[model samples]
Target: MSRRNVYLDLIPPRQAVQRACDALNRKELVQTETIPTHEAAGRTLATSVTARCSSPTFHSAAMDGVAVRAADTFAAREDAPLELQKGRDYDPVNTGNPLPEGRDAVIMIENVLQVDDSTIRIEAPAFPWNHVRRIGEDIVATELLLPQGRVLSAYDVGALLAAGIWEIQVLERLRMTFIPTGDEVLDFSQRPTPQPGQVIESNSQVFASLARSWNAIPSRTATIPDDAAALTQAVRDALASDAHIVVVGAGSSAGSRDYTKAVFEQVGTLLCHGINVMPGKPTLLAEAQGKLLVGAPGYPVSAVICFEDVLAPIAAYLSRRDAPQRRSLPVQLIRRTPSRLGQEEVVRLAVGEVRGRFLAAPLSRGAGMITTLTEAQAVTRIPTSVDGVEAGKTVTAELLVPEAELSRVLIHVGSHDNTLDLLADALMGLEVPLRLTSSHVGSMGGLTAVKNGTALFAGAHLFDPETRDFNFPFLRRYLPNLAVQVVNLAIRHQGLIVPRGNPKGIQGVSDLTRKDIRFINRQRGAGTRILLDHHLEVEGVDFEQVRGYEHEEFTHMAVAVNVLTGAADCGLGIRAAAEALDLDFVPLARERYDLIFPAEHAEDFRLQALLALIGTEAFKQRINNLGGYETTLTGQTMHPGQGLE
Candidate 1:
C-alpha cells in the first residue's frame, strides 16, 4: 500500500473532529459508574434519576409556629378573640416538623397570644394550609429529578439528598493515558541538564493539564523511544487498562523517525492522518481495541491545539457532556493576517482596549513558540475559505483571559529590549497587578501600532544620521500631528557579541567585511539594524561585504544564542545579552532606549504607574545591576523635536 502525503489529504477541522466523535459513537464508548451524589457535581448523569421518596413525606410545618385546626380560629377577630386548647386543637411546631394529625393549618407564634402553657389565644383567623408544607410539595415519589445527560451541580446535590438519594449513576470520567515518544526528549523530572539536541519532555504535562481542565482523568506514561515496536507495545498496554483514550505525543509527523502513525495503523484503524489546521496539522486520530487513540504533534502549541480541537470534544462526548464554550469578543485587527487559501488558521493575539476599542495584535505563529500561548489574551480563527483578513477588519476573537483584564493591560508594540521583560515583572508585582503585553515587530512596526492607536506605548530607539539624534526626529517626521511624550527608559550599550576570548577577533564594523567571520543581523525595520546601517555607512563599508548579514534574528537574545551555538561568529546586540550567554562583548556605542506614548495616554493609570516606578531609587538600582544600562536620564519625559542633550 502506498502512503499518501497527509498534508495533501488535509481535511477541514470540522470534518476531522466529527470523524473522531463518529468513531466513539459507533463504538458505544459511553459507560456509566455509580458515585455518591455529593461528589457528583460537574459529572453528567448517565441514568435518569428518580425520587426514592417524596420530600417532606408527611404534612410538615413551613415555619416556627403553632399547628391548629382552621375551625378553632373561625370566630377569632381583632375585636373578639378565641382560645384553643393545646394537644386538642393546637400543637407547638418548629420549621420542617410534621404537623399534628388533627391540625389543618399553622398560625405563626407572633399571632398566637400565649395565655398559659396549656392554651393559646388568637385575634386573627388561621387560613387553611397557611404556613403549612403539604406532602409531595417539593418532589413526588418515583418522579424524575434529573434527566440523563444532565450535568450535576451543587444545588442538584441538595435536591438529590432531599429526595432520599445517596448515590447516582453518572457517565464515567474519561480516562486518558498519554505516552511521550522521542529519542531526543529528556525527562525533566530528574532535573537533567540536557546536552545539545535534547529537549525537555513537557508536552505530556501540557496535555495532562488540559485534560484535567475538561473534567477527564489523565496519566502520563514514561517516555518511549521512536522505535515502532516500543510505541506499539505502549499503545497495547494502555488499551489493556481502564483508559478509554490513549495519546501518543511527538511522533505524528512524517519524519523518518515518526512512528506514531505507523504504530497506530499496525494496532488498529487510522481514522484520519491530518487536519487542515495550522500548527496542529499533523494531528492523528485512530480506533483500536474498542478504544480511541490520538497522536498529538510534538510542538507545545500544536499539542495544546490538538487537545482542544480534537481530543477534548471526544472526551466530552464519551462523558455525555457538551463541549465547553469558548468566550469570544469582536476585536479590530492591528495588521493583515494572510493564510493558505484552503487551510484554517488559529492566530494568537495580545488583546487590549485602547481609545475605547479592542485591538488585537497577533503573536508569533511558530508552532514551537510556547511563550506566545502564555502571553496571548485571545485567539482569532480564520476559516478555510478566505485568503486572509485585512488590517482594521472586525474579527471575532475567542478570549483566553477574562474580558475585564484587557482594560488593565498596557500594550507595548515595538523594538525588542530586555528591560521590557524586567518592567513587565515589576508592574505585575504592584498592589493592583498590571499586565504588560508587548509585540516585538521592530521599531518601525511599533511606531505604526502607536500611530494607529493600537498600542498604549511603543519602545523606540530610531537613529538619524543627519541630525545625530535618537527618536525625536522620526517622531516629528511620522507622527507630525499626534502629540507624543518620549520618556527615557535607559541608555544601553550596543556592540558586537562574540564567543568568549574573542575567537574571531572581530574588532569593529569594518571587520565584518572579512570573509571568514560570519555575522548575524537583526530583522529589517529593527532599530538595531538601522544603527548597524548608519555605522556601516560612516565606516565606508558595504553590507554585501559582510558574510551572513542577511541572516536575521528578531531579538538581541536570539542573536546571542546564534553566536553561542556556533551558528555565527558574532552579532550586534546589547552588552547585557552577551553577558547573559557568557559571551564576550566589544563596546561600540551607547544609545537611548525610550518609551513613546501618545500625549492623551500620559495620564493613564497604568502608564502613570509605570513612570512612577521607573523613577524610584529601587528601580534605578535594578537597572544598574543589569550591567549595560545607565539610569541617569531614566523617567524624564520630552516632547517631539526636543533636543537630546
Candidate 2:
C-alpha cells in the first residue's frame, strides 16, 4: 500500500524475459507420435500430413441448380426463352452434386422458371463456366492437408477426412502436474470463498487451462502442505507418475514456507530462479531425469505469466510442438507508466475506441489481482530501464485475443468522436468481425494518418472558413490522390472539457491563452487540434502564447483524466468525454466529423462495419445520447470532388 518505494535498478524487457526462458532446458526434449485425424483437433502436428487424395475429386455443383452445356445455352436469348426438359436437356442437381458428363455450366433454380411437363425456361444465357465448381477446386489429391508442426484447426479435421487420411502424426501431448505449496493456500473446490488473508488456490486452474489451450494435458493439480517434507513427497509423486512436465505453484520465493527450490534441488538440478519480471519474479526452472519442472508464482497474473514464460515453452519442447496463441502489436501509449529499473513489467490493458482511433488504457496491476487480466485485451511490456512509457510514446504489446481481430478493426487515430462505437457495434453478426480502434488525437492528426496511410480511416472535423466547409480542403491539400469516400460520422460541437460544475471559471477558446490556465491539448495533426488551431487563427490567438500548450494525450478519457487530476485546466474534445467524467463542456465550434480513408480502402471489409453502424437506428440512438452530436451524415458517402467541407 506504500506509494513510496526506493527506486531499483532496471533491465531491458526482452532480455529479462529471454533470460528466464534461456535458463530452461528446452532444446533436448521431444515426445511425439501419430494419432487419428479426427482426434487431432487439439493436437499439434509432429510431422507434415500430406493429403492422400484431392478434395472434390470431380467437377461438382456448388449450389442446387440445373446443369447444361455452355454450348447448348450460348444462343439462348431473353425474348426467345430456351426451354429445357429434365432427363434430356439437363439434370436437376442439388448443392455438392457432381457435374454430369458433357455439362460445363449451371443455371440457378431461381434463374429459370418452371413450365409444364418437366420443362424449364431460361431468361438469359448462362456463361460457359457459370456456377461450376471445377475438379480439385478446393484441394488437389495427395497434397498437404497440414504441414509439419502445423496445429490442426476445425476445418483441417474436415479436410483430413475428405482427403482419405485416417490418421495423422502429432506431437505427443505434454503431461503436466501442478503441486500447490503454501501454508496460506486453500483449494477453490466447493468453497464459500476464503475470508481476507486466507488464499483460494486458483493459479493451478490458470496453468491447467492455459496448458490445455496449448494442446498439453495437465495430469494432476495437488495442493501439498507447506512444509519441505510434504513438498518433497509431492515432487516425488509427480516424477513417479507419467507426467512430462511438473509445475510447483506458490512456493518458489525465498520465503520460509516456499520450499520449491529446496525440494527441486533435493531431487533434481535447479536451473534458475527469480526472473527479472514484476509480479512473477520468483519463478523456478529445473530438469530431472528427462523431465522438466517449472515452479510458478502464486499470484494470478504472475501464475499466468510464468505459465506463458516458463511452462509453455517446455510443453512445446516435450511435444515437439509449437502452438500459436494470440497475436501482438505495437501501439502508442495513452498515458505515462513507470516500471522498476531491474525488472520487466507486464502491464495489462483494456483497449478501447476513442475518436475513431484505438487506444490502450493501462489496467490496475498487482500479482494477486486476476480481475485486471480478465478485463484486459492485451499485455503491454515496460522495460526495466525506464519507469514507464510516457504518454504518446509507442510500445509493443502481445494480444491475448486473436490477430484476425486487427483486420476487423478500423483503426482511427484522431479526434474524440462517439459515432465510431456506434458504427462498429452495428456490425453485429456481419460476415467479418468489425471493431474500431480509435486513438483520440485532434482532427488534424487524423487527417495526417489518412495522408500517411497509417490509419484505415480517421474521424476528422477540420473546418475551413475560406471555403466555408469541413475536411474537403484539408483532404484535397494533404491527401491528394487519396481517393476517399468521406461519410459523415457525426456533426459535433468542438469544446473545452472541464471538471464538473465549471470549477475553472473558464469560458471560450480564448481562455486557453490565460497565463493561470493549464491545458491538456490534443495531439498534433488531430482533428480536434485542427479545430483548435483554426479557432485560434481566426481569433488571432497564438497557441505558443498559451500555458501548458505542449501537454497532450491520445484519447478523450486521458485528456479528461488530466483535468480530473488537476494536471490541466481543460482540453479540446467531444462533450461525451466531459459528461462521462462528470466534467463541464464549453462549446467553441461546430464541425462535421467524417471518416477519412485511402480511396483504395473504401471497400475494405472492415469499413462495411462502420457503414452498418451508421445506417442503424440503434446506433443513431447511441449517438443521440452523446450531447452536441448530429447524425445526418451518418451513412452518406461524400466522394473526392464533393464540396461538403
Candidate 3:
C-alpha cells in the first residue's frame, strides 16, 4: 500500500491560528528598514516618529494682507479712519509670507483702502496676532508625530514631510512565496486548455492578489509535480530565501497522491493539519527554519478561505498591523439551507435590500465552485452546533461588497432562464447600473420566497392543466391574500435535450419507457418537472420505468451539461440550454414565463427601470435573437385569466 499522510487532530480555526501565532517570534523573524517617508504609505512603523523641525518654522502670515503691529493700528476705527505709510506702519504680505520683524497682527487687504502706492487707510482696529500663524502653530519640534506599530496612510506621508522627517523606519513587508504542487495542475500563464483530470493553476495568483492587499510581498514558483522529494526541496528552497511564509498549493488532503503533509513533516514541525471549517478543513500549518509553511487545498473556494481566514491573520501579526475586517449586517434567509454538524460552513449569499430589510439567499456550497464567491455579495456562517438554518430566519452576514451596493441589487428568486441572463446584462447598461442577483430554487420555491417577502421579485412559469393557464392559477391557490403584478418576460419552448447526433434514438415522451433510455430530471418544485410529469401521463408511461429519472439538476444549463457530458442520454429543459451546448432538442411545449412582483413594490425605481427596459425595441430584439423565444408579449403586464393569448 502506498503511504498516505494522516491529518493532525482537527482544531477550531481560532485555536489553529493561535498555535501559529505563539510558535513564531515576530521580533526575530521580521526586521525593520529605513525608507523615504514619502514611500512609506501603507507600511507599519517600526519605531515612533518625532518632528525634527516644527511646521511654519518662523512666524508667517495666514492670509494675503498687510502685516502690522497691533499698537500702531489701535487708533483705527470704523467711524474714524486712520492712514499710515506702508513701510513705516505695515508691511505687505501674502499668505504664507514671513511676518515682518515687529509685526504682531495682520490686516485684511479688503479692510485697507489704498490711497497711494506705499500707504493705506484702515477703519477697523487690528487685534494682536489676528490671522497670523505663529511659530510651531501646526506642529511642534521634537513632538511625537506617529506612534510605533501604526499603519501609515497617504495623509501620514504629508504630515511626515511637513514635520521635516525625511525618512522613516518601517517594518519590512512580509514576503510570501507560493509553490503550486500537483501533477494534475497546469500553469495558467501558458493558457493551456485543461484535459479531463487537469485543472489550470490559479490559486497562487489569487493568493498573490490577496497578499498585496495585506501589504505583503508575494512571489510564485512554477508548478511542481506530486513527488515527495521534489516538494521537500521546493519548501527548503523557499525557506532558504527571504520569504517569511511558504504556501504549497494542492496535495494537502489525505489522498494517496498527496505529499505536502509528508514534506511538511520532513522539513518542519506540523502545527496543524486540519481546521474545523468546511471547504477549508485540509489546511496545513507548519513552522520550519523560523518561517511559516502552509499546505493549501486545490479547491478554489477552499484555497480562498485558507488565504483569507487562516493565512491573512498570521500575516497581519507579522506585519505589525491589524487584520482587515468586513462590515456585517443582519439578513433574512430566503430558503432553508442544511449543513453538517461538525464543521462550520461558510455559506455565500446573494444579498440585496428587499423593501426596507435585507434578504439573503444561499448560493452553491461546492468547494470547487469559484463562481459562487464571485456572484455573492455577502456570506453567513452556519454554526457547528446547528444542523441548518430555516427559511425566514435572520442571521448576521459579513458583507463582501460595499453596503451601498445592496440597494442597487435586484433580487430574483425563481426559475432559471437564459433570457434572464440577457435581462441582467441589459440592466447593467443603465445610467445607474442595477445588479440582478438570482437564486434558482424552481418556480414554486420562487412563489414561497415572494409569500415570505424575501425577494424583490420572482420568475415563475407554473402551468395549470385544468385551467390551461400559467402562474395565475398557482397564485390563486397558494397565495390568496398577497397582492402581486405579473409581467410576461417571454414565451419559451421546452424540449428534451439530447446529444448533438441523438445517439439514443429518443423520439418522444413514450420513449422514456424504454430501458435503454436514461433521463435527467429537475428538482421537485421546478416548473419543468411538472411539465415532464404531464407529458409522461399523456404518453401513458410510468415514471418508475424511466432510468435516471430520480437524478435531479437545479437549472436548465445544469440539465444540458449532463447530456453534453454523456452522463444522461437526454433531459427536459428550455431550447436555449440545448442551443447553448450545441445539443439536439425535441420540442415538447411552449410556456409563458412571467416576472411576479409584490404589488407594494410595483413603483420601486429598480422595478420600474426593469419594466421600461424590457419594453424597449432593442431589448425585444435581443430576446428574438436568442433563437428559442417569442417576443410578441415580451414586456406586457398580465391580468387574471389571460392564458397564452
lDDT tens digits, residues 1-645, model 2? 212211132233234344434554444444577788888886777777777777678888877889998778867788989988887888888888989988888889888888976898897888877898887787787776678767688888998888888988776777789887776788788583776567887887887788887777785555788777888888988888888778898877766567787778888876667677887787777777667777788878888877886566556555556634556777666656778775778898756433445556566677888978865667887877787777667777788766555455556666766556555566645666565555565677677666765566777777777777778888878777777777877777668998888876889888888888888887777667667778888889998977877887767777888998778889888787787788889988777777776767756666665676577777776888977787776767765444443
Question: How do the residues 250-314 of candidate 1 rate in per-residue lDDT, one tens digit apiece?
Answer: 88988778888888889998889888889899999999877899999999988888889888777
Rank the candidate models, highest TM-score first. Answer: 3, 1, 2
Pick the lDDT winner: 3
Error of 2 at 4 (Å): 27
Candidate 3 residue-wise lDDT, 131-230, digit = tens: 9999999899999989999999999999999999999999999999999988999989999999989999999999999999999999999889988888
| Residue 337 shift from truth in candidate 1, angstroms | 1.0
Per-model TM values vs. the true structure: 0.92, 0.54, 0.97
Best candidate according to TM-score: 3
Per-candidate local distance difference test = 0.89, 0.73, 0.92
Where does model 2 exceed 4 Å of error?
Answer: 1-30, 33-35, 57-95, 98-135, 190-197, 316-336, 349-365, 374-378, 389-645
Q: Please state every model's RMSD to the true fold in angstroms.
A: 2.9, 12.8, 1.6
Model 2 lDDT, residue 254, Cα: 66
- Which is superior by lDDT, 1 or 3? 3
Instruction: Give me the displacement of residue 223 in model 3, in angstroms.
Output: 1.2
